[model samples]
Target: MGAVSEPLIQWFELNRRLLPFRQEPSAYHIWVSEIMLQQTRVSAALPYYERFVAELPDPAALAACDPDKLRKLWQGLGYYSRVANMQKAAQIVCRQYGGQLPADYAALRALPGIGDYTAGAIASIAFGIPAPAVDGNVLRVFARLDNSSADITKPAAKREFTARVLEEMPKERPGPYNEALMELGALVCLPNGAPKCEVCPLAAQCKGRAAGRAEQLPVKTAKPEKTLVPVTAALITGPQGVLLQRRPSKGLLAGLWQPFAFEGTAMTQPELDAALRTIGLCVQWQAPLQSTRHVFTHRIWQISGFCGTAAGPAPEGCVWASRAELNGEYAVPSAFAGIMRQWRPE
Candidate 1:
């Protein structure tokens, strides 16, 4: 406690940008923003935050929002399950507790989508509890301050760092203290190999300073390589509308609509012809709309999007979702976010 200075607090007090979630911090807003910010940049998150807050202002409002609309809003943000779960959690709160976000940490954590990080954020920012909001940003700050070679990706190291910070959290201004710690990491103790210490408040206490490996203090294990995958998507269309398949209710892109894609391999021209014929109607196949390259953390897809016209009745087992049906009535994964821009309503 004695190690921190007026300079540190002052720097944050004057420099911290007033954020959307902080303006009138509430449990709901803090929880939503924290989940959105996970593995996402602040600049990328601001619009999503604003739109989400506007659309779902409170528990009841969120509870009432169609899950598809929620997912659509969250489209392109990635890690979409987090958003979906929040809505489910909100509905649960509404049902069990009358639309109010629970105040207790255990209760909050128990919500469908609320995790440890989100629970801490809401508890500290909205409730002013002494709980520390330890996130990757906070972890990086502590790792630099202690100047230790701890692998941050490990749970034990994360828990140890969080416990120490929780001990030091100033009870009176817990929000400020939390923000200060996170701010330090986001601005001064940057990741990806650069840190600006000339303006750092904790410059004197940084163990990395003495050790000369500040950028390397909070180490992490090497990332595994992404396996390459090949998938093909169809543009099966007729008067009944575009033929689409509903993804199985569970797994990647679960419950979303997709064209009948030839998964796992490029269609040999002959295979392509057979696939086109199998759809129950046939017409000339325009050249593929160009191969769509989509990347996921565990897998990379070299997907080819084909344009085809159908001359007969829509096939069985495939749903012909119309343009009206596609706008807000259905939920699709962000992987389609880019392709939708090229789609025409007609």
Candidate 2:
């Protein structure tokens, strides 16, 4: 035990939020929660996490779930690849580990999408192993504690932070200790704005606080600017419903449904009609819908499109979906949420 361990764990026990995953610290639950929380806030991810666990309770269940259903389950949660990798890992777990996540840290790391931080979390929290689950929160905490101005985005910084976390980890109660560190960072040592050091258990020991640089300790490299991609979609409608096309099996928003779209910002009515003609549908152009933008990790989609009625057979790569079908069957990503809202059946 170290100087910070006992007080931090004590603070965690008294102040930790009553999360679903914490109530049931199973390996599967931990894995799902950790992955979902990677880029999402706890409040935003709660309903999704609950719904997901209720539907696919175990590794075997997740492995055998329908791909479309899987996409639907993870619809609003962006980064579809994370869920995809999770399914792959579930399949492997079913084949090799008999449907239960492996207890060993190395084995968990070997699974798809499970990195060092995730592996450590599952190992320590779910399996009671003495491993350091150093994530962004923990890194920030460590940087402030040591008052070191290291670029936490680098691999070397992560390694150093992990080692420091391990040194302070209480072996007998590693789960609570690790969770405590994470909780402290989330609740008190916040990333944005001023950290609430007054209430933080480690405030006394935080060197950054003493040096009046707690908010500036965990430096990070600036990310490159997101590329802007202009898209023109056709919300062609008819007696059936809305026209939705399936994106390619691989790439951004892979295997998801969206409106038939082109790669340019502005498309004239004649050009759109011609484009629809090439796809075997003659659409009577109505009016342009409100344009919107969706931001991805590396790019932003500046989307603009038109809604029209098409009285013809469905095109080869497209399907006409009734509002019910759209709601019940297809997994449409949120990138086209603006267009869908305007053109979907009332």
Candidate 3:
């Protein structure tokens, strides 16, 4: 251990949060938490983590879980693909490694959804193996400490930072050192503006602070702007229940359920009537509900909604889910939350 790693490890011992997984550390717990935390915050992931672990306690349970039920468990988390890949990896674990996540970093990396950062996290944090988990938080911390103007989004910058982390990481206390770096970045060395250097453990040794560039050291390429996609979602209600349709099995929000939706902005009366006829629903449109928006990674759903009564059998490739089923069983994504709020069943 050198100047950076040793002090960071000491600081981590005193300031690490009492997270659920850290309480009773295990490879499975760490692996699951790491996957959930990707592109998600700790506060947001907490309840999901508790619920997920309680429901799918081990690899065997995860491997044997019904795919729909699994999707239900992961509802509202977004990035549904992660959970799907996790299931596939769980099945592999049960067959290949006796229902336990592999201890070796390389083996963990080979699993679906487990990348180099996640593998290193599980290996060092859960198994006490000497590996470095360099995430965005760690990247920010190191960039400030070294005052490097490298574009952190590039692979070459990440590799260089990873090498630095490994070189300075303590062989005996890699876990604490890694955790401390992440914690410091998240709490003290925040990304938005000036870092709280007064409370930072590395204040005295930070090159970015010395150069008055702590907030500007870690440069990154800007991402493309999200495209707006106009959509009109319908709340087609009947005596049995509200009609919901299952999305196709291979794209955004795959295998999830949503209300009957049509592309384009708010539909004309003729357009709405035609849409209802296609679904075997013949009825007058009720009051117009509020329009809302749901943002995805690269697309935005500008949703307009209407409540209408339908008198017909459920259409093929769809289900007329009762209010009870919708409340207790169905896992509608948050994209339709606004429509659900304004829905008035007639």
* Candidate with maximal lDDT: 2
Cα lDDT tens digits for candidate 2, 1-346? 5798999999998999999999999999999999999989999999999999999999999999999899999998989999999999999999999999999999999999999899999999999999889988999999999998889999988888889999999899899999998898888999964799999998888999999999776899989999999898888888999988998989888898998888645787788788778878888888997888999999989988788898767778788899999998899999888889997564
Error (Å) of candidate 3 at residue 118 is 0.9
Q: Across residues 1-346, which tens digit of lDDT does each residue of candidate 3 receive?
A: 4798777777888888999988977889988898999978999999999999999999899999998889888888889999999999999999999999988999999999899999999899888899999999999988998899889999999999999889889898778878888889888999876699998989999999999999776899988999899888878787888888898899888888888887656786578778778767786678776888999999998998677777677788788888788876777888988887665555
Candidate 1 yields a Cα-based lDDT of 0.76
Q: Against the unseen true structure, what C-alpha lDDT does each candidate score?
A: 0.76, 0.91, 0.87
- How badly does each model clash, as a count of residue pairs? 1, 0, 0
Q: Tens digit of lDDT per residue, candidate 1, span 1-346?
A: 6355345667789888789988868888888888888868989999999999998899888888876677777876877667768878988999999888887888888998777877877877788776767888888888888886788899999998988787767777777788787888888889876888778888887888768878776788988998888886766666766666777756676566667677688765567778767655565666566667778879987877666666565566567667877765666666655454445446
Off by over 4 Å in 1: 5-7, 237-243, 276-283, 311-329, 337-346
C-alpha TM-scores of all predictions: 0.89, 0.97, 0.96
- Model 1 per-residue lDDT at 159: 91
